[model samples]
Target: MSGLDETLLDDTEATVRVRFVVNGRKVACEVAPRETLVDCLRNELELTGTHAGCEMGACGACLVQLDGRAVHSCLMYAVQADGARIDTIEGLTESGVIADLQAEFHRRNALQCGFCTPGMLVNAHELLSQVAEPNREEIRDALSGNYCRCTGYEAIVDAIDAVAKARCEGGGAT
Candidate 1:
């Protein structure tokens, strides 16, 4: 083998210790160099709400809020989350924001099979946090990343619009 090939084979694999705030709790975990954030959330922390669909960052099933921004967990390395604040779907109910969304989803029949609800809720929550009264276009744009095969998006849009209207009218969604 060439010297360069030999050196490449000898390269060491490092285990990184990452510390981050997840789901309102501080957590520390040792992860491999290539371990994705979704793996840590589901495998290590057992937070299964963050699903893995495409594993290519396309389905948005692994969506989570990283530092208050909606990010695809499958697209991020666990080590990259070190010292960052991460919020999964599980964290949403603690504040009732997600619960409200979930309730609205149910009322509007926005979910079926239940696989995409978590990601959808996380994305919707992030949108509502920034724009409490987003219009139909804005809601559609915000949820464009998430894919739900069960609902044709009409119900989902209705659910989001209902939430926005409730929030704007000085009323709680749930």
Candidate 2:
């Protein structure tokens, strides 16, 4: 109906019913048995913020937080996420927990094409949450799984470090 393509929703063969909480909302959908979490989010729920880069999980574009831990959605099947709480870029952005990080990223020009921003942010959120003040090597190690073709990662490292420092100093990019 309208501008939405119906065929995308009609292909339900060899599908399994999956129920999970996404972005604080409970979502239940029928997905193909081999459907990946990234595919389900992008195709079924339309949460395209989780990019599908290097679907084999080498690239971190399809990163999402599963039960507060960052995981590559491309590597996990949608069915595997059943009964789990999932959070994507949309959820983090809406919760305002990453506002400061986003601002720092923008100010530091950490993002170029923006494909890896979501995953980077998700991973950064995890890192910052765990380590109040991570060193340069720690930050780099945390983001090592995420591959950024553009920007050479210097700016991204700077942005995460800046946010961590500001937060520790009682003020940040928020």
Candidate 3:
């Protein structure tokens, strides 16, 4: 092949460098321009907690907190995360917020298959962060994007409501 053709080929196959802060750690890596955030997290950063289901963003299984907001990893390009703060499921529990929620989930038997647990936890965390005392309707609205094939959502709502009630009574609500 000619030099020009080789250059074109390289350009087509070139991996772009993406820089971002994941779970409070700086990360810089080369990834295909077309790669999604889920791929980068799982394959490059090795943060497998971000699941890939219904890659079209319909299923909230790939939920992650980007710049303090919950987003579907499969819907975002890895390059778009440059200079962003990313938090996968691994980061959710480190601050003890998710731990409390997890305890509540266990107490409520909110999880069954566990595939949707991470996304549910992250979404719940986001909801609680924004509204410390969200009602059942609000909690359901917050989790509208997430799909739970098991557990039927009653227990999940109960868990969240209990946590909210506890926080309100404990003066943890702001």
lDDT of each: 0.88, 0.94, 0.88
Off by over 4 Å in 3: 1-10, 171-174
- Tally clashes: model 2: 0
User: lDDT of candidate 3 vs native?
Assistant: 0.88
**TM-score, cand. 1:** 0.90
Tens digits of per-residue lDDT for model 1, 1-174: 445545534534657689999978999998886889999999989999899999998888899999999999999899889999999988876777677778899987999898999899988988898997999999999888899998899999999999889888888665
- Model 2 root-mean-square deviation: 7.4
Residue-level lDDT of model 2, residues 5-94, one tens digit each, is 667577656677999999999999998868999999999999989999999988899999999999999998999999999999999999
Model 1 bad stretches (over 4 Å): 1-12
Can you give the TM-score per candidate against the true fold? Answer: 0.90, 0.91, 0.90
Clashing pairs in 1: none
Point out the higher-scoring one by TM-score: 2 or 3: 2
